[model samples]
Target: MPPDLAIAHDFPLASCNTFGIDARARCYVRIASVAELAAALADPRLAGMPRLLLGGGSNIVLTGDFDGVVLHMAIMGREVLGEEGPDGKFTLVRAAAGENWHALVQWTLAQGLGGLENMSLIPGTVGAAPIQNIGAYGVELKDVLHSVTVYELATGRLRSMAASACRFGYRDSVFKHQDGKGLVIVDVTFALPTAWRANLGYAELAQAVAGAGLGAPGPADISEIVVAIRRRKLPDPALIGNAGSFFKNPVVSKTRCAELLAAFPALVHHAQRDGSEKLAAGWLIDQCGWKGRKLGAAGVYPKQALVLVNNGGATGAEVLALARAITDDVRQRYGVTLEPEPVFV
Candidate 1:
């Protein structure tokens, strides 16, 4: 594809991303290996432009046909980068950003590793995992992220940075910030725990997995539960185009949450670190009566209030406009801001 240029825009990304509805990349390539990807970046036509690093296409919104080249890091290789230790080798997993994330999780569980079981069934790449400090149930990628291999956009310099350099926080890291901006992630490493305790701390996950009777749940048990819950809840992108969880639940002081709760006794909320409370953005959108509401091509997901979907032929602009309306309405009613979870390009 593209004369040995790894694989070119010979394929369209309409179905590649979870947001099933979207424009195509002007020039696209699937670099089967990270070395080939590095070579592509060295090519003059592709050098020195504002580049976008994509993994599984689960967490992005393509507003329009891209003017720049899209580098699909399809490089696939998973290696134990180090020796196992007394507990379990402080195993190192070096994965190209393109590998299906859930598939990898299944692999790790099969091998008896434990750090990523809670993150099982998340719909993005290994590269983007550290970007959002991807979390589910009770575990976060930040808790296990060892390092990230990146290709800097402005200078094409490849560097491996540690977790501290990633500036991790609540659903955020340096890759999520503007400071470490313009870096294209190629590979990532995670230190999964051996003899790990399954994270049954999440209420729903606790009930379901514990009920699965998997005999004192391990990584495999938790993975099955996660996939089951996700399948039951999230609409497959293949069926309907959508980016999961359109907004982040705003973290506010408990005092503020009490004020809102006083206003609406049913205001759904969760406790967080210190005296903070995590308000559900979905609950807010649902409170505004946006659930399952239709507007031409775009509509709020019928099953999950957090997801915005493209009914059939919705353009990115229409989807974004709908999101803005929801945000404005929620803000107006609750006096709290709703932030988007997906990275926009």
Candidate 2:
């Protein structure tokens, strides 16, 4: 380890993960600078051990204790990359990995940037955003993402990849693939258009904006509405230990969707641009009688069936069990597999 590196042994991680699972790392370190990250990557003590790169810990679940070195990213910085397009119509802004994702969105809105408003109130750090192709309402990170800077752990080299090279898909990207493994994202850059346009394609968001009497809402207006909607529909993780949206909406074939629609007239779904149907996982879980149900200290959020909450003193195993039970139930009933949104460790 570097002389200035801060490393902890057997660090407690009960408060790190949003799910509030009581897990411990055999070794843990906070990487606040690129030099520190490089040093950690080269540490012989940690070289052969399993490594977990943690950012905000909002989009992960610890099923058990981690018997490896946990690198908690804390690097911080942000700057305007420069202006481009006709009449300088586009501005590229970059944010460090440790910066709060929502705080970055708020900062962009404060600067009169509008592309990120629809994704307001989402959790996790900016570094993890593109890894999952994070999306909300009608916009995805890919829509505004310019590039990402990453430290290749295997080679101890820094590199950058443009948005197109990320190979973004629904809730996935190149960062999640084997070839992209051992890469630690340090920061993210977003290309925001100076010309603002409100994305009101999502029905609920459009309805909310309309009801607010804003025929044409600005970035701030849209952000406030999204925050309000999220506050009402999702439990605050600080108040209740839970990760938002425990499962991704399962995409199914159009024929399968139509068959299910005939059998269950009340099914809620969205037609994807590719002619497939995305079924609401929450609705499927709710139909299987999981809402507000409990197994040990883990339970489904009463307000949103999509969320799984830690109902006071929940263990990682308990949470995992509950998730597995719900997954099995949904699969058996609908013939659709439900994939977890969080990274399971």
Candidate 3:
């Protein structure tokens, strides 16, 4: 072990993860710097042990105790790297992986940066954002991402990767794949537009802004509205044990979408730029009568059918069972397989 590295044994992880599953890590370490991370990884005592790189724990479901090492990223910092792009049209800002994601959004807004306003109040750390390509309202991380600094575990060296190299997609990135298994994000950089425009691409957001009587809404206005909307729709992980939305909105071919529309006239869907259609997973779960329904201690959130909650003392197995049941029901009824958003551990 490195001189500065402190490893704890049998660490309780109920509070680490948003789902609050009572799982334990055989060994755990809080990594506050890249040097410390590299040193710990190089230590021979921990060699060949499976590792879990944990961030805000907002996007994972622990099924049982992990019999390996848990690297809890705690690196922190944020700064303005000044302007970039053609004729200096964008402001480049960077943040460490351990920083709270929502806090970073607020900080950027405080600095008069506007591009991140549409994604306000998302949970998780900055490092986890790129891995999941976190998005909300009408904005995604990829839209403003400049690049990411990562510590390659295999070589014990640092590398800066461009957004394109990350291969971002709807709720996905390279970090989720086998090729990215050895990479650990240390920080992220974003290019915020100098001339900002409010993104009201989502109807609910546009209606809320209009209803608020803001004839000309600013970035702050959009951010406040998005925060309010999320507060009203999503359950706070502190009060309720949940990992936000449980499933991704299934995308289907235009022909398939048309067929489903003909069979179910009231089906909720949004057209994708790729000529496919994205169906609302929440609406599907609700239509299947899973909202507010429970199996053991696991249940669907009453306000949002997309969220699955641990009502009280719910085991991870119970949550998995509930998810499977919901998926099976939705598939049986609509012929669409619902893919879960959270990583199952």
Q: Name the candidate that leads on TM-score.
A: 3
Residue range 190-251, candidate 2, lDDT tens digits: 99988888889999999999999998789999999999999999999889999899899999
lDDT of 1: 0.80
- Clashing residue pairs, backbone N/CA/C < 3 A, model 3: none
Tens digits of lDDT, candidate 1, 1-20? 42457435534667767887
How many clashes in each candidate?
A: 3, 0, 0
Superposed Cα deviation of residue 306, candidate 3 (Å): 0.2
Worst 10 residues of 3 by lDDT: 1-10
The Cα local distance difference test for each model comes to 0.80, 0.91, 0.94
Candidate number with greatest lDDT? 3
Query: Which residue runs of candidate 1 sit more than 4 Å off their true CA positions?
Result: 1-11, 47-50, 82-89, 213-215
Error of 1 at 44 (Å): 2.7
Per residue, candidate 3 scores C-alpha lDDT tens digits across 154-222 of 798899999999999999999999999889999999999998989999999999999999999988899
Which candidate model has the greater lDDT, 2 or 3? Answer: 3
Model 1: pairs clashing at backbone N, Cα or C within 3 Å: 20-241, 84-89, 85-89
- Mind sharing the TM-score for model 2? 0.97
Sorted by TM-score (best first), the order is 3, 2, 1
